[model samples]
Target chain A: MPSDSHEIVTQVYAAKKDNKAADSFIEAYMPFIRSETAKFTGRQPSQSDDELSIAMFAFYEAIRSYSRFKGAFLKYASVNIKRRLIDNSRRERRKLGVVSLDQPAGDNEGSSVLSEIIEDKGRPYDELEEREAVHQELAELTERLSVLGITLSDAAENSPHQKRTLEACRKAVDFARSEPGIIEDFLRTRRIPLSAIAQATGESRKTLERHRRYLAVVLLIFSGGFETIQEHIIQTLKGGAER
Target chain B: MRYIVAECHPAYAILLDENAELVYAANLHYSVGQTVESPVLMETEKTSGNRSAIMHTVRRAAATAAACLLIFGAYRLYMGSADRSAGSTIFMSANASVCMEINNKGEVISVKALNENGEALLSGYSYKGKDKATVSDELVELSISYGYISSGDTVSFYIDAPESGVYDSYRTELLGRLGSYPINTDIQKYDSSVQVRSDFTVSTQATSAQPETAANSTQSYSSMTETAETPAADTEAVTNSTVSTPADEQQAESAYPYHDPETYTGQSGEGNENWHGSGDHGYWYEESTDEEENESSTSEDTDQPYNRRHDWSDGYGRYGQDDDDEDICQYSEDDCDTSSESSWNSWFTGWSGYRFYSYCEREEVSECGGTDICTYDTGRDSYFSCEHGTECVQPDDTTDETEETEKTENMDETE
Candidate 1:
């Protein structure tokens, strides 16, 4: 039992970094994923089933995100698979009509029905382009964070849990944005000027130091022309303040 | 909360929300850059490790403090109540009876009246902040002022303590205070080791013994007065006449001598036995005979004239006059011996005014000098002169001595 658990943890850690390892890990947990989908749907799901595909995707996501802190990998994967299947079912219910998008164009031979899609004001294409732009912005932010010896996971982990501490971090970010030199200094030194931020914003040095990596990520996103990421953080801060 | 698929993976996709923050979501046949609304997102643990640890420590500390406060509060309540209910108990009985609950520090915790008279005696009295001795002194004074106890009446104290030494100390302190009053007091001790009887009735024996002592002393004084008035009277016949006389006037005279302090020690010592004996007339008579001997010894030590006055005036002269008034006549007898001792002290203490007042009053002399000096002192060049002749003449010395000696012999015979 211990060896099996050790193997599962080892596979999940490997799968987080390697796409092939993640694919193989999903294939190995296919039976477990099917069982979780079966529990949610209350019936056996075939290979072609959409719920089965969603559960498989959820299992793969669990592998990518699994850490020792989250406890037994199988239990975590089972919960993720069940939740994903429920979400998919709910989303499917909200659709007004289901279109295949692969339907044949009646007038043109060898043309799919997707070619006739003009009504919806090109929303899907625009959404797709917007998604690509967001992806570019995120990739840029990820690259900048890596330069500061921080991962996206580390930033998520070190983010302040308490509202007061989060407000203090935001204040320090605001101060850095106001004084461009501080942001330049951070980028040059690759270090958060905790004492200067503490003095300028009246936030304690300890708070800035404790959340130094998260502050660095926010500051870099703001200074490095990552407008998509910056707007996302501003919206989140506004929503938190409203709450 | 819509998300656009930013990057697609075989297992999960990095999706960007409208806010542009990247999130991990399950990929369901999604191509790269495909916009997806309401995607199934990964659930990350909300609380950080450090925050959870701080919360756990804070919870444990709060629980510990609550437990400690509960225990301490319960203990304080228990001890406070324990102090109130624990300690020595004292039952004081004059004509009125009261039971005092005292703490270890000798403070009076409560004073409960045992009967109607006791309730009346303690009415409007506050015992708060007063120690046992002070409370006792005040209670005895109240007993007198309220007429629950007066000249020669007995006040009895029953003390029950956690130890014999405690009982002894209470007995001594109480007796000492009560001795100052012109009344008799008796003390009985009980060790706390013995289970105290729940029934708080003053013992029948103790109650009966006090009156018996008072009656014996009253009877002796009557006999002595009879001997002084009629020198030819038979001693046994005179002793038997005790039951016929009104003893209030003589009892009042007996109370006066208590102004002398020397007699207080002897009276207190005698108070111990007054409650010890069974209420047997024979026992009391024997005790009175002992008192007579002590008196005779005192008379021998003092001057002849003073002895004659003491022997005549301090006897049960008023006992015969107040026969119907048993309260005054009965208890008057207890002070006869003390009166003999007081006569000696009163002379040096210049209590001559009190002596003359008692003398003139008892004799019913209408024109006895200024109501302060008896007409008997007119023959001597003393503190006061009288216009009236010395109506109180000395009885023939030989005859008076013969009568006293005979009375002593008869009392001894009776014993």
Candidate 2:
């Protein structure tokens, strides 16, 4: 209603500030995440409802961590969508015979692996929530990594989605940094369909459905990687996209 | 998706899905064997851009890159056939030449007197005589024209300028007076001292300005028969290539000056030290008494010239002072002891509104000195000069008595 959508976003941002209430806000917005990720769904062979769940949690993360000053929550949410999609694609490629994670992949396999994406659902909801929690813990554990001559950026980059996916996921976590409840309100007003939101936000639907593995992590120091609210927090996104 | 020659320009082309639904094609480039891999559709919508294929021989992949580079003001010139014909004179003079000339990181080779009358003329770098090279860095080579270079009916090689400068001499042979054929290139690795020089005067039109008095056509430039008096400017004069400045053009220009001179005093012997203003613009010095002295004494093929053309160059010695005197630029009371362009006749007097040094330049200068010393030149002029460096003022051309009497009027001779 204001000159920019950023104006409406500011409200949701205000609500997300209370980390205690971030879960409802995230749940209400999971549909948006589902729809956004759905666009990239067919592109990955391993893409499934489960991946949607992880992306949903990621969306919750975007909601919880989003800041109004960063513009519309959607803009910040876009990066989260891409991260979940790519992470899921990369994981699926490795799980299937399509791509070998340990091998030095030549350029030839890049296209072939790209073609093999999106044949199955993403990781299950329970498994993703556990993984998300461990990641959160791992992020906290990594603070001492610098003592081992490991840089946060370097280690993060070498991890799952490399530094890029970590950054994407991290962005979603910071979504609630500003006004908190704006995402929930936005989803309610728009009546964001979970699947539609999932596809758009790139959060996993499974992660969206089982939304509290991370919601209880409020007492956990918002330390680096505690998927504290991962279930209640984030999800892998699904969508059909061009490589 | 395949491309045709007509709309192959890539801006406008209609694309359709197998279902005949219109697919918006933002941009695309396809050659004879080009392959366009389809996107993988959703399990529910499994048909858009879905394919498992390999492709080959793409000149470039950015269906949008060409347009993007175009936005960046860069373009590609796909070389064509017909370069073998010696007399073929293709290309217009309004634009930078692409086919004939070449440049390295530091130096630009002016192709002023190329004779296309011979078989090697058209084959400057394209395969006929040389092999195409692949470089890991950005490369640029432009030819101005193809003809002969000579001032009159005779192509002349003029000698001027200092040593550490870019070229030793600027010349163009004129058996035929080539219009303007300059080879301009951006050197990814610009090392001033190590740039390659072509001093040989074979039937080759391109030659360095390293003075060659009695060298034969076959004489190697490295084995100098005789070094010219001044460090000759070895600029290859291409047909009609002027490399002129834009008075104040906002358009994009080369960072290198080729033959542009910048004096230490910072005025333009030809122009100002555009090192900051524009890359092509070099530091310059104006004419005044001290400039007269240096021009008279130095035969070292003119070290970086304090410009003769710019009056202010000589007046301030381009540093806004004089060449003969030794004074640095002026700053605030706390910064320096003096002010700049305070002279009655200086351009800064009327236009500058009030005397305030360009803060950027003022910040870098050392503290000012006491007893501002005004010195004389070969021509004997005087003005307020600093202790370590001389001020940029002209020598009093008048006789000694007149100079003394004039000093008496201002009560300041700076003796």
Candidate 3:
């Protein structure tokens, strides 16, 4: 009996000359292509998906270029396929932005653009009912923030104005996200856990204390039950205000 | 870790600009159930002001988008349509040298010789759709033509290598020719081994022959052919024989060293049933059967264990007797020294190989007239009566010995 390498060599040589053989080689590895694409995309890729097509083309390209010196065929093919899918996704992201701020807030009849929702300053009176609802939500948020001795005025005063300071404050919020114990402790004790935040973030304790109120508001939104304001705060922190 | 907890008012904005001014507008401290008007300026502020601000922002954004679209549309109109030649496809042979550009209706647009010498050879020939000719040089031959496949407007270039040029040159030339067109091109290169004068006449014939000839020339073709011809039958037979041979051979070898000559001959005869390398074991079985028949005819030979064992040995010899004896002996010294020796071997053997050993042993004992004795050999207890077919104890003799002991005890007590 011929070894596995021998069999593959024959199939590859046949594939180079015959269209049917080349197609059969592709058809045989279709499941493998789908699995690799799914691994990269984090979801099962379907036949109609552009990612699947890119993976299949990468597999074909691998077959054309493969030699015995390249080692195992599937290993080489898998690496090539994954790299191609990643490159394709990056290119697609550049050409067609994956996350669009233009999407409507919801299926509700009066739902406005996400950009408007994130920038809450100029809400139209037609959305006054929604604004009234947000007013009550803000009252609740104020009650929550007061647990950390942070008032609305404190947050306004503590809000970072310079881009560098905003970035540093954003990093602190990100640190708080990864370490939820700090948020829980702050809520339970009614004070910012500055040392814990510093330890987790490797930031100076003073820096965390200075941005305590701003971080408190960010953390409260992240703590859940405040979707609209959370989206706005997150976008603003990501420099969406300048955009 | 802080022990001190303080109560503080959370009724205020944290991130908004001038949030302290906005907090007085919150009006959360209003007296419950009060009929008085609240002093919240932001809430009571007219909605017209907010609406105007929103309208101004929306209008500005719309104007910006319109301006971007206008610029993009203008750029597309000015510079985009220059490179697009509608429905024109290019076809080149295996080498990039010989090229033919065809229009939408399968009409030849231009034929170019990319190589140095072939420029003059293919130039002035107006092969425009009527370009059906075999241009041959000292090295190779070119058959170029315009034709139709199911996918419309195919330019088939059959490269015929008559004397001496590499297939790569022709193929590279064909690829280069197709690469120049800004349209979807299908360039099919016929096998270089076959020499055809024109693509129009022999396109179908050469295309069909390519796969077969390519299959024949492959280095692994013989192995592939073997795999293809009797795929099902050969796979099954090969796999079964390959799997079973090593196991059976090991058993035969393991039995060979320790068994008595007569028992070894019997065991090997049955163990090697699947082993066809030797002379027919069928003939061996027949000769042994004749001897057994003659021996059994002599009814006076009841003492011979082989005579009593032959009936049960037929089944046991094939599967178990030879193999299980070693296991039973191994278990006897270590485990059978305990009180439950016999049952432990039975349990161990039952769980291991010989799932049917228990049933076979019971049947064999019964078929030996139910008087077949269980002899305790110090080497290995008689797990099977005819494993050696030599030593066995009758069940009636053991019963007699127990009765004698009972009688002796009664006599002593009476005295």
Candidate 4:
């Protein structure tokens, strides 16, 4: 199995420079690609399935661009396969005349589809609601950030660049979540409880101060009713922990 | 290089790149599933960028100022200590003695008077902003104006500095400045090992006399008196002479007439014996004789009574006139023809105890022909007016008569 993984990494590397190697590498990862598509489609992807074909194209694209910096070749190919399948689903939804969940539903002037619709078990609708919730949460976060003289762009720039520093920031967010007083103070003052976070998490005051804006945004997402935004951060942090 | 728009929001879009990484970029009105290159990603805010740039510039400026302060502080520390120990001290002596402390640049920092005459000489003088040479020249000019120095008198300089080069430079500069003056200039390096005598006693009577000539006459008389009295007693007399004479007088005596009798006596009590027995006596005697001659010649030209008294005393002591006290008194009466009555009386008053008695005996036996009886009476009264009390009269008693004869015999043998 190790040899197979090693062979896949070598093939992906060669494929980055040559198209024939990309095709060959994509063919080799067909099972992994179908499995990723199956996870999205909830079934085996037949050869005629356009999702299957899209997943294959995504795997080929992954091979054409893959480098050692991208981590395991199989995991990278799987992510590309899933992304392409999602893109295909959105493209089909567009064909079905659904512009965006954020847009008003059926000529309703001030109401979004997400506000008007009931909860549905349909995958597209569920995805639409999740995206709509994320968009709403992001809008709410943007407004709250502006009150603190911060912008989403400033939050992104002030975000810790190093993985360890990012983890430290996540730890600060978790500490703020556990300590209700910290969240209340942060909400009332619209400022990060920098010294409190540093003292509780054993992180340096300098590091916390450097990422104060980003920490404020993340703590707001955790402490407020911004569930969708908070989930995004949790997923990313989980991914980081897994790595 | 290519990203497919997976999800679009009001603020940003989640774009799926070929690397499978989801990136948040600014939404430029893009539809989902649209493949695009060069989408507007969320860039750093203009305010944050400007703030960072300003902060960077502030940090750099603070660092530069700190470096400049550190360099300046270190420079001040180094220069402060260097300035503390960098100066030279100049000791200038005529009859007036002044000490000038100078900096490395030769500028006088302070002037201190070493005697009362020096204080009078420097009363109206200011050394501010003047260099060593300028200050020395001004001081010399002041001494001349105060009559502390004359055409034939010597103005001696002693320089104490951190380096010999400083001494030499100061000497050269002072010589160049005072070379045109009529007075003689004597410059020498000062040895700190030799203890400087600050308490210099000058007689008001001889203030106008040449300091070197008067000092030589006094030192010769003091040494002769010391030798005539006791060899061990010479130390106290030499110390008294050293303390009473001006600094230049002591220096001249040390350089020519006498080697520091204190140092010689400190080595052993036989200092007087070594002083006379050593070949140094002839050179010293010759130098003293030459000084007396020069003093006599200048006295005739200048009409100084102090110089004539010095000549009389110097000749009396050196020619061993104590052997025939009667003939010496006759000679003093004959010399009174050339000097004023008061000067002659004052000269007689300055005589030693033995000579005072011999002069009294001469006045009793001989008629005061060339000299008046009042002159004799004045000398007798002045001699007895000293605070010595009965000690002044003890020399005439029988107990001290043997001691006086012994001193007279010692004086004859030394001559």
Q: Give the number of the best model, judged by DockQ.
A: 1
Give the winner by TM-score.
1
Tens-place lDDT digits, model 4, residues B1-415: 5665655543345554433234555455666655568654432222234554465456435544553465467558645533432256677865777666566567775665655676677776677778888989888888898888889887778776656776777888888999999989888876533323343322322222122222232433221211111113332333234322234445655554433323544321224331222211110111224443333222221132222221111112331222222231323544332222212212212223212111211111223212212122222212211111111223344755775566445435544
TM-scores of chain A, one for each prediction = 0.65, 0.35, 0.43, 0.49
Candidates 2 and 3 compared: the better one by lDDT is 3
lDDT (10s digit) by residue, model 2, range A135-217 = 44544534434343443323211222112222333333344223245345332452223354345456544333222112112
Model 4, docking class? incorrect
Q: Please report, in order, the local distance difference test score of every candidate based on alpha carbons.
A: 0.55, 0.30, 0.41, 0.52
Error of 2 at A9 (Å): 3.5
Rate residue B372 of model 4 by lDDT.
18
**TM-scores for all predictions:** 0.39, 0.22, 0.20, 0.29
Q: What does chain B score (TM) in every candidate?
A: 0.34, 0.16, 0.16, 0.38
> Residue-wise lDDT of candidate 3 within B268-342, one digit each (tens)?
353433211111111111222444333322212111212112211221233222333432121232322212221
Candidate numbers sorted by lDDT from highest down: 1, 4, 3, 2
Error of 1 at A73 (Å): 10
Predictions' DockQ, in order: 0.11, 0.01, 0.02, 0.01
| RMSD of model 4 against the true structure | 46.6
The count of backbone overlaps in candidate 2 is 171
lDDT of 4 by residue, A35-72 (tens): 88889999998776767766666665565445443578
DockQ of prediction 4: 0.01
